[model samples]
Target: MSCSDPRGISLGPRQIADGVYWVGVNDCLKDLFESLWPIPDGVSYNAYAVVGSEGAAIIDGVDEHLTYEYVEKIREVVGDLGRVKYIVINHLEPDHHASTPRLLELAENAVVLVSTVGARILESLYRVPRERIVEVKDGERVSLGDKTLRFVYTPWLHWPETMMTYLEEGGVLFSCDAFGSYGALVRGIFDDEVDLDYYLEEAKRYFSNIVFKYSKNVLEAVDKIEKLGLEIRILAPSHGPVYRKRISEIISLYRDLSLPKPCARATVVYGSMYGRTEEVVQTIERVLERSGVSVDLVDAARTHPSYTLSLVAESAAVVFVFPTYDASVFPPVREVINYLHVKQAGRGRLAAVVNTFSWGPSAKEAVDALSRAGFQILEPVVSTKSLPSPEDRRKIEELAERLSSELRKFGSCA
Candidate 1:
């Protein structure tokens, strides 16, 4: 049911339920998300239009560039844009509210609904007028004749003012960024409509890149949903698919990621010069594999931080192999560690540092950084000279064995 547009191309508003329309836009052009994470597969800004008999409410907004398409989608569904009563800002992030100002100008009758914290910052961020803003609290309900929009204040969901909107009648939870992923919707919006496995994997990467640092907050948000007894038949997030058939799987995915029951795999990240560090990396992988441990090797200089973080975040153990450059840890290797520390990864996970240096020591730098990032490092910090001498190779094997044994304790080994 796609149609051509007068101004440009539009996916149009495809209804997911009786009165709810998916009025989102795909952004496949941006190379990097948040100017940090690489999103080669692109991303989507999923907004919604919920129409009741008397009035209509628009849940979330798209990136600033797609303002026209978003507004047209709303107009397509609601006919008279003035009939829109509430422009709900589930999260104050610009991706979800960039078009709020323009939409506000179009839908003159609508007032902006945001959380108490969101209200305070909306004017500053989006130049939205305070008079047009309405502050919503946890469990607050706004009636739109036949449909009722309930707000759950789920703060610290990667943002302090984040909250979710529940359509009380439809069992649809318009979760803002909690279950978001980083893929543009090419086929359809529902979980079963598109490739579920691809989106689910993207969801994991999105969690590691965006929401992992606030894992505790994520757990609290999930618990809040359970305690409130919200019958969430559909999980409509701000990014990626609208989960219907696989709602339970998506919910459990979020819960598990927050608790971070890492999979039975290990990631080996190496930054090598002169092939010395690579030598140790390969040997370690072989040993781990022989010991019944699955291994993923990542070249720190070649792999983007987005993929690296995703791989490292879900693995049971990590082996960092790098050579000392200028008597310090290699720059590329150091960058990965910084991201791990910033994103709050490595917590309760095992890590082993393999260092090769021509001069003074550099293993201590990696050891300290990994420890700060919450990794339980294996003992003796494997250090070697310029190459793998007989003694150095023996130490490398010993380190791999220790790491594999610790991974075995986690019950991941075959």
Candidate 2:
């Protein structure tokens, strides 16, 4: 699908379901998402417009930078701005609601709808009169003539005030940032129209980087939906393509990602100030490969933590190889460990350490960090002096054998 539109919009407003139009914007200009994770495929800020028999509502808003085009897309769907009576904010993250100020200016008659927490936080972010803000509770229903909007509280799906809007008549769930992905929707608007393979990986990466920390909350939110028995026909997230044909597939994928199960693969996350530590890593990789163990080798100096977090979170075992520096852990390796903790990637996982030092052997720092991150440290915390000697190489091979044996026991989740 071509990603160009004559009006400079990446995609024109497209219909996802009856009376529900996608007013999302593809942001190819930004190199990163949240000024952190890289977005080589770009990202999308998805918004939606739901037209009812009596009144119209816009679900979420695009980034502030895309305000003009966003409002224009709404105009394309709603025709008259005055017809918009509600601006439902599922999540108030700037990426989703930054353009709301300008959008409210255009739709002067529209009232802002938010959850209880959203009401408190939205006031801090935007200037809206008390009468204009309607705070809804979980399971609360708002009437839009023929269509009814149900609010489901799904906090920490990245933020405290996050929630989802369910359209009763259309069986559409407007989940902002919950079932989201990173890549821009350049191909098409719906899941059936786009390439599923590419978007799924982007979604996994998005989950690993952004939502993995609140994975328990994500599972809770999913359970809430299940217990309530909400039949979601269309999953309209704040980013990526809308899921219509494969709603169940994305929902299942999200559930699996949220629950950290042991996969057979191992992720080798390492940092090397010099060539010494990398040489040890090479030996370990070769042994693991020859033993028929699948491995993902990530150089902490070169790879971003977001990508590594994705691999480590799913892998059953994670091996850290870094040289001790200044009588402490290597800085880059420490950064990766910090991110692993924040992402909760080490929870219920096995970890091993290979420390190389020219002066002092400082395996304490690596062990403490990994233990704090909830990794079950394996035996033989191999420490070497600068580079591996013949004896050190034997120890390394022993460590590899242990890892290979343990990895074989843990089955793959792929």
Candidate 3:
């Protein structure tokens, strides 16, 4: 059984395990996710359905805009909508649970399951009432005939009330947003069926952009699960792949990203208005490349902060180059820095600043911004006027050399 979307692609529920189907929706039409992050590769709002001999439950929901398509997918899987007994809301984020209210209208027999705190704000967020909502505490379990599900309170998984639902018999963990990625499923939905490399990389970006801010919470959640001795045979996140074969790999990656054992890579981000700062960035990029130091360059003026944050997450070092504007750090660069600071980025990283100005240098503004973002600013902040003179070029080289040497010292010996 298949369902149609605006892209003319046939997407239907794929049985990920016995009695468990991935009834998710992919939105290829949205240019931007949440109207901010760029989704050039598109993204999926994944949901799942679990059927037992006695009852059926669906985990998560898609965006409200595609209510009909999502409901149709549910129908395809369950046949009669009345058979749907439970609508499990792991997280109350709109992209995941926005379709719940509409689903509730049809599934008259269904009762909404959510976290205790989720119950408080459920009505305010989706207008789902308390009567239909059953708030679950941590370690609480509900059985649907032969299959059993447990709720674990994993708060601050980017939201205060977020939780993950664990299926007992099959050992499936429907992690709400953890281990999520940006790309939509194409050839298949499971790790074995899709391109593992692409999804894993996207998962890294997704973690950095969405979940890494609450890395401590992620670690706690993982630890909690381990202490419970729950065998998570499958990682059924609300987005991206349903990891079965590579369960340990995904879990290990999240732990590393959570602790943020940063690689010896660097991110060179800059906004050049009149090409002077561009000259410095080009010089730095060349030096980094020559040293065999893996690096990512982001043009802050053109690229969104959503991308910049992801690039910076994996980098052990960040070099910010920008021209001073209005006697302050360049607006675009400043904005990116602010976003990083707000997200508590730069936990284990080094930073360098290069400023170009027509009159007085604004190198201090850039340095102060990075400092507020928790970066350890390296020495020799380079500043140039109009264009880089011989002295400015020499200082730029020194800074690049220092950064490259630092990367090598941090285990990226290559």
Clashes of each: 0, 1, 0
Question: What is the Cα-based lDDT of residue 161 in candidate 3?
Answer: 93
Q: What's the residue-level lDDT of 200 in candidate 1?
A: 91
- Model 2 — which ten-residue stretch has the worst lDDT? 1-10
- Candidate 1 wrong stretches, greater than 4 Å: 1-10, 262-264
Tell me the deviation in Å of residue 309 in model 3: 2.1
Give the CA lDDT, 0 to 100, for residue 123 in model 2: 75
Tens-digit lDDT track for model 2 on 94-202? 8988898888878989988998998989878878778888888999998889989999999988899999999998999998998888887877778877777888988
Candidates, ranked, lDDT: 1, 2, 3
Instruction: TM-score winner between 1 and 2, please give it.
Output: 1
- Weakest ten-residue segment in model 1 by summed lDDT: 1-10
Please give the lDDT score at residue 188 for candidate 3: 72
TM-score of each: 0.95, 0.94, 0.92
RMSD of 1: 3.1
What is residue 49's positional error in candidate 2, in angstroms? 0.5
lDDT for each of the candidates?
Answer: 0.88, 0.87, 0.86
